[model samples]
Target: MEELVLYGTLAAAGASGPRNPQKMKSGQQNHNNSSIVVCDLHSGTPYQTFKNVSLPRGSTLQAVHATSDRVFSVQHNSSVLLVYHWGRDSAVQTIVLPEKLAVVKVSPSGNWLIGGAQTGRIYIWEVMSGNLVAVREKHYQEVTVIEFGRDDDSFVFTGSKDSTVLGWRLYDLVNSGECQPVYSWNKVHSLEITGVRLGYGLRNVYTSSLDNTLRCWDLERNELVSTYILPEKIKAIAMDPSERAVYAGLINGDIIIVNRYKLNPTTGMVEGPKGNNEKVTLTYQDNSDILLTRPDSDTKASVTCLDISFDGTVLAAGYSDGQAYTWDITTKQVLRKLAPQKEAVSSIQIVSRSRKVIPGGIKLTGNNSNMLAKKKNDTSAEIFKLPIFKRILDEKEIENHNVWVKLADAPKQEVDDLAQVKVKMAKFLHEPRFIASAKVSKSNVAALTGRVKELEAQLQRAKDLKQAKEMM
Candidate 1:
């Protein structure tokens, strides 16, 4: 099992104070030599760092995705996908993939796990059984990113470095092992695809590529609705909670925010011309841009990944130089900037959903219990008991005995009445044993009084006899 890594805890954010390069070396454990730091976004500071996690000796950490209960991480050049409880060093499970994975994602429901491999074969595993349910070989190059539809886990989206984006129906993959995508667009980007996102109700899927294009697709109609070609290569993207807008992080360390399509209230579809609208011209917007470099600084760090809070109030962007910034999405102002580390921040995840915190500070949510229950039921041990032996009897005796036993086995009410009677009778018989300890009776008093009277009469007679002897 790989050593477990946790990024955040419920502790005070300033427990470790600001990030220190000297303390960074001490923050890691001796056995595992790296740390996964947890930060409290509410306090905007570092909370805790876990270092005891075991990883493949020479492999580097890849992407990290977490639900309310568990944190899932993958490693480069390693086939094992390590799972850890939120804010703990103990690994709950390790899933072995068919091939080394470059990217991994868990459904919002946490019932599914998908690992994208370098060979373009995507492995899908059912979280309940931890079994590989399907292996999809749709992309020709490395699968760069994969995401589940926000509405549910039934739909999955994948983008490959081969410059294509495909939408897969999970039901078909699990039921029939179908590798062909239900919705697909080939060579949508001129360069490698970097990020893929399922916008809002999953009706719109977004893709960002190195060719400097952000394409939006209408998955329901399988048509490209809009495309925003940028000035620089885009590395990462995140959608707001309301699905009103999307933020794109570019290689130039600039964060670009773009508005998404509006939905029709009655039809619950994109509020545009319906059906075969592929001939419709695409709309491109380019006014939103926020630069990361300070006024006094000349160096610019490339934005590597982006994540928005559950409420869409804050936006977190990770840069190529390991620096990270959190901005208030409404005001478009920087909230906090974390110190730089040695490696680039490949992914950013904001802990959002509220969870029931159990004693000892562990989360006792439904997902954690389900994971434990699955592990217990998947074991193959069978229980066995020795059979009892009985002696054979003659038919006549057996008949007589069986008849008596059946007759004695009366109704439950009658059995209960008989038990009460037996208890009363036992109490009545035992009353005699306690007779000596009972209170004194009238007969015992009368017997003592008679004995006293007899002694007094004897004393009077002796007195009379002594007087007669004196007179003689």
Candidate 2:
């Protein structure tokens, strides 16, 4: 397998990608190798093929910091995703996952995408193509959540409503034409999974279940390492850039911040020997600390979607009431907001990609409308001086910022409740049977301990109002 490794990395990555379409034409190339599709959001909406694709091209996002009268943020730009336009007011892809999209992760380099479908299938898509690159159906009840291991191996791991979290090598799933579970939990959770996220570098897997708690697993050892009990059912989970503690959003509109008390991210290890596999240590305790938060400070709005930029400059939360707000992570204050949709946001991502808009550059000529002409008439009428024509053009331009997405109405899970669900899964991890299964390496365990301290410092800065910035 390693023999062809050089070929996969160096040769086809660029330069010869399209011309040597020989591999794709042969139909034998694994979907894992490539998936490429592009769309024009405006003119080709109805005729587009892929249903799950959408792009934010040519559209302007409502600037959250702007006034209501401003038109730039009202409409969006054209995107390559599947766009079904019933009219001017309609153009968003809708997909109903078999269960709920437990976890939707776009690859770091943007080559591939992965998400767990409610049908207990691990859905893999090619990024630009919006194609179902591959599908791994291995779960029984439903695939509640999934994460791609952040290691060089690039494996896929999933947590299920059946109370199980299983790991699999990606290439194995691609070549074997079937999903073979590496680890299975007869009872991973008492309820459904609502929140889940893989650790930054794949040292751990964290999940929140309907059972009202969060669970952290040691993937290498296949054991439950620690658990966190939140104030309410966990709804969303986002790790700090440092991977210290995670900010979990709950159904009750509260976010619980779980601290490692002692763990490390850099080395992927726990400091103390806090385990049950013939191991004993001082901090046998689980969950160093849990802090409650409200991703959305508004009293009435429930968070529908949440995302943090890679640099942690913006923390955006989409509401069930059809509003999206950006907050200052450091100061914890709302910087800008938009009420764009009437429906809850199925997903929210602080993507760096943006649509480009070019104006028509048309000029208007009128008898009674021009302010420049009024001065020439010697009547100097200030009543007709409002630059009405220019305003009309401005509004026309504002409402026309046609934003398009690349995904279509293809089915997937509704991960809207993920953060809260992982919290419940935490309890199951705390269970003795599960604890006995974890592989806590001395270095792995020690690494986790150190990362905890590093993350604590970051979270403290985020909580202390020393952080939070406006996003572009």
Candidate 3:
């Protein structure tokens, strides 16, 4: 062993030392431990329970909505749009949809909102005005779905189980009467118009049906572009932004992605084996073909409503049960499962634009900061909901803090660094004394900032997961 090590080390270590240690940047040091951040936006697991119904008992809870700040559970009733908050363990703003509120959408510009409900009704409301500007009840069977066009708000499309697809001019809405039918096909589905979507860049509308066929519609010429049949009835349809492929989530526990890829010169039809098995293919793009199936379980289901982000990075599926799953399209990995809905998601939309603020500016720490103010609210009235355990928590938390400080005291670099930060941070906690002293100082600021960020991220992730479970 020594001879072998000597030979290899001499041959490889030529100039530098034998140990290939990683260098620590001045302010970029980090812990060796790995951590995960589960977002309600993607594939985090949720905890759920239900009263038995029938064979598909646990799966009926599926309402999903995606907006700029939140991914949510949709409302079937005229009640209110649910904005699920991963941090609050509850929902915010149960938005009342205009009219009877069948379908709702925040425009691509994030300025206007449109709500379409039963009996061919539509309402356009400006969020800033918090008031409805116009109402058009033009449909025949309750607006079933709504899709906002990209790049411009010039036009939007709607599909109804009434077996019709309509494209309305956003600019000429007032003068536009008897809304023009971009495309209409009653033969697309016999049961109910399940889903309709415009293909990316194709100017053609795609429609899916309870009858199990996905048909493309050319609104301008009023024609059916093409039709592809699935193994079973259809539940959801999503077209990737590239327009080369489309995914039809089925009632057969299968996600069938069809590529507009033609196998032969004259044949435009593309086909693959159908089953509850897992499959992935590379055709339309990197994440072209994918098949989703429930694992070995007592429950089986068909996805009710599903959506994929524009870039095809995030894919979400809402089940008949009040549940939603977000998937990493390329890796075929589940990222975070939004909490399950109490009922099946009538629809689901994803907000594609998300960003991290570019370190806005210099952060000024001082005594008057919010960190100091939160320390003052240490009352049973403020801390507890029920009267029984309020005092007990205050006393226990106080003791716990002292115990933690003592336990963390040590001579090791990490331990010492942590202990010092702990004491300072304790002074800035929910209840503390001399909160001003806890303000961050520039000295060793990077280390402290990284540590604080790490802790906050970990805590936020845990909080998001817990909320997701309760929401389910």
Which candidate leads the pack in TM-score?
A: 1
TM-score preference between candidates 1 and 3, better one: 1
Steric clashes per prediction: 5, 97, 25
Q: Is 2 or 3 the stronger prediction by lDDT?
A: 3
Residue-level lDDT tens digits of model 3 in 1-472: 0000000000011122112112311112122111111233532432111111111111111224344443333333233444332222233233434333455566667556666666667666544334444566556776677776766676777766576666777655423245553434544456566676665453767777777777766666666556676767887788877776787888755676676653554666564333222233332234324565544223565677777776676776766554566766676656665654444444455544434211211122232211111113332111111001011113333234221111222445555787889987876685544566667778779998899999999999999999999999
lDDT of 3: 0.49
- Candidate 3 segments exceeding 4 Å error: 1-64, 70-99, 174-189, 265-290, 326-347, 353-472
lDDT of 2 by residue, 123-186 (tens): 6654333344456777776554555643344766666667666777766654425567676655
lDDT of 3 at 337: 55
RMSD of candidate 3 to true structure, Å: 27.1
How would you order the candidates by lDDT, starting with the best? 1, 3, 2
Alpha-carbon shift of residue 47 in model 2 (angstroms): 25
